[model samples]
Target chain A: MAKVLMKGNEAIGAAAIKAGCKYFFGYPITPQNELPEYMARELPNIGGVFLQAESEVAAINMVYGAAGAGARVMTSSSSPGIALKQEGISYIAGAELPCVIVNIVRGGPGLGGIQPAQSDYYQATRGGGNGDYRHLVYAPATIQETVDLLMEAFDVAEQYRNPVMVIGDGMIGQMMEPVEFKEPKKRPIAPKTWSTDGTKGERKPNIINSLYIDPQELEDHVIRLENKYAEMKENETRYENYNVKDADVVVVAYGTTSRVVKNAIAKCEEEGIKIGLIRPITLWPFPDKAFEEITDRTKGILTVEMSTGQMIDDVKIAINGRKPVHFYGRTGGMVPIPDAIVEEIKKISGGVK
Target chain B: MLKDNRIRVITGHYGSGKTEFAVNYAVKLAGVNKKVAIVDLDVVNPYFRSREKEGFLSDLGIRVIGSSIKGASSDLPAISGEVLTPLQDETFEAVLDVGGDPIGARSLGRYHEYFQKGKYDMLFVINANRFETQTKEKTIAYLKNIEVQSRAKVTGLINNTHLLRSTTIEDVLRGQELCKEVSEELNVPIRYVSCIENVAKELPKDIEGEIFPIKMYMREDWMS
Candidate 1:
């Protein structure tokens, strides 16, 4: 297929359709509005369903309904909108339903602004919903990677029977890039026999519920969920290490912020600063193994983010104080520029030698 | 070789390269010692606005006008009174980079009175690769819609179809065909066929409109 210029939001919608997702439930929000709009226009043509629920809460519950019925389903929103869907996400996780939730994050603790941001790092990686549950969170940096992950996201969701969240900043939705829709490597997704599809009176009907009336039953269920997350951590943790084998400083970044970091690394290279990068593609798994790739010669790890300091905690936890972890960030819809990141790296490199 | 209009207003669907065309046109006018100024009336899109290139264009002796707020990160919909300077002053060759879609063009409507009282050309940029303006019917609909919203008729069409840094010669020719169809249907002249210098050179001389060789000014090197 020829490479076509696509906005990140619309490309994600197309990837969902290509992955055979038949139902979409979402509310309108800036940055991610184009996604639901695209689905509204295209899904009906393919004999699929596109429903713009009255609110994000209603939309996510609709996702719960569709996922329980064994349909490939999706919902997308921006920061605040995604916040509204958290409870439903937890419910879906408890029910062990397979679905895809896309969050084109904008700056906010609450209604912060409509610009590119990575402030929702905790909301995505740490389950904003209640109870002990986990889901795969893929933070893709480029539009091509977003497309590939989105296509495979459905498979991963079904394979694990958990909701998969694909989070990108607002720039990911706004930027235009040439992307080819290549097939992602397929995962071994078992049949949805666990779904609450009608049994046709010939077999036992499948039940989909999160409510555990018995205390021990609920504990058992929670443990089972933890084991599934453990399986994910073992099998799905992914990261990208750039020039980390030997470097004075290793910078950690993800999503749109990582692209800016790449630019800063190039500038540092030109200045003979020798900066490396560890880009975590999966925020939930945290890619702790990536920290091992950093050579012992590295002086420190600098975590860069669009938020004041969210993902830096993960970096510290991953490294476990192996090296001093420093943070450089901009918040409230402000994006960190390449020059600023270069300055931060220069400061870190200055102390090294 | 293009028309030397005093005020050139660029409008198009989102991602149709309207900002890119306006930036190239202003830079070209400045190259010939024309006193050029750019009014970025794009309030719809937060990223990739002509205002983002204010520093670069200002360094080249071209005045770049954006919102009333001087801060580049401010995403408010406010337009500056400074825009009136270029439109009112005949000595200044002005280029208005209006936003994408009719909603974006509504910002241009605020200056309808000034544009009505003067000689100006509103060029509807067409990118066949863009989903909204791919077909003749869709292009015509968007053109008429923009006119309704901006309260101004599109005087000419600019073929600016591209896939960022990956644009090929065939893409331009494919866009030329669509632009020609929309041009003949709406009776709007094809004013320019804009593309990167390499693809512009590959274009046949017989193609309609002057071939405008443009650099990838709006796109970053990493974006490719």
Candidate 2:
């Protein structure tokens, strides 16, 4: 409703509030502590609930509790914190609850530094938590995108009756930029039909859970999740193509690093370095088809990241090595400067004599 | 401390509770009627910092400036707001809360000229367990890199290493010892060692410097 300067984390929190998310449960973790803190302050004013749970595990369970009561719910944490929440997330997904999870990722495999990183690409896309379930994943590169996608995530989660994740990194969370809040759209009231509200006349008691002892029933549930994922692949794929027309080199990146790659492309354009960017907005259902088309036009594809080339593996798979695919990145939360990216582009294009 | 308005740089490793310390210190200064402002220059990490609580700081009459998501694109002109004006003014006291690690410190390069123009104090927050530099020597080396990039001298040390959920008194003492060792070795003053009150009670009497309490938002009695 108002034009405000907001960081990516704040934007997501605001969007969630506007999108009728009345319940937020989260633990403080970097590069995403802002989201929870924002919620803690704002939720009370809106007659909503915010709980800083004991741990990430406890926070996810609180989300599960809120979602079960048919309240729009959300939880946020960084890579390591998200790892701890995976158990609850997996359970939430199995129960087909509608909830939004935000992961402002940092470098990881362990307790990583609180710097922007894209190492969680595989984790977010391939399912960070275990199970035969898939959470609808939206990877937002900009603060505005973070808000927009967070809103979209709620709708997607409700539509599929599953969990949705708005995956970003430290860069998006910390950066403050101007954003105009879109006019609030009319949101559907929380679906009370199947929720576990107190049993009333003509309605049976509703139980939402991941536990199913029957082998056939579990198989049926797995099949349902698989079908939902397949449908998402067909209908929910999102990506952005930048200056891709007749490009010699295509750079593939997502989240914060994509912006850096785009800047590098612009810089290189001055020197007649024709490079393009394919930024995947949805990391899950990774835009393989989009890269396939770009590969045909470009001589080679490069994946840039703030990690040790984690997303490059996915790019290689997407291209199937039909065109030369290269990896350029800095690990341990080190972001490649535009100059370094330009150098790599020159090396790949043979523009450097 | 020089009277010519200077930008103070505060930094530390992640989970070091540097954000809490910065917020408290900034608020404490403002409470004493100082014309204070804090620039959240921590773009490296997303979660725990003054930037994350910009609204809170702004509410307290302290200006909080930082790069937003829109500025994530390097092509976008760095649009600093009114906070820059006060930093340049001689009457204002500004604190720059640099991000968790070296990458966060890198952002200080842009404000190097401002630091050079005025008196500045760069405080390196040390947590004993974080980074590859767990010991004093390694921590100093890390701080040196930060100083080289930010062009600001590390004038003080604030030891704040503690486990998030299970912090004990022993941990704070260990942090104090490390801070003392680093202070003596680097010839830097130990400004204040941060500790949660629960753990601060068990701290030995020999630990130097004033003890600052960490106020986390999660605590139910935070307002009290």
Which prediction has the highest DockQ against the true structure? Answer: 1
Q: What is the lDDT of residue A326 in candidate 1?
A: 94
Q: For model 1, how does the per-residue alpha-carbon lDDT over B1-224 read when each residue is reduced to its tens digit?
A: 34546788999988889999899889988899989999999888777899989889998899999999876556778999899999999899999999888999999888888675338889999998887787999999999999999999888899999998778999999999999999889888999999999899899999999999999898765566
DockQ of each: 0.45, 0.07
- Cα lDDT tens digits, model 2, B1-224, are 23323677787664456677778778877887887777777665534446656677777888777664432222222436654766688677788777766766777777777776336777788766443346888887888888877777787888776654356676667777888888898898787777777776677666676677776642222011
Residue runs of model 1 more than 4 Å from their true location after superposition:
A351-353, B30-37, B53-92, B106-118, B134-141, B144-151, B184-187, B197-207
Best by TM-score: 1
Give one digit per residue, the lDDT tens place, for model 1 in A1-353: 86777889889988999999989999998878779988998999999999999999999999999999999999999999999999999999999999999999988888878888999999998878999999999999989999999999999999999999999999999898877788878689888778778888968988889999999999999999999999999999999999988899999999888888999888888778888899999999999998888878888899999998899999999899789999999988787889988888878778334
Estimate the overall C-alpha local distance difference test score of candidate 1: 0.90
Q: State candidate 1's DockQ.
A: 0.45
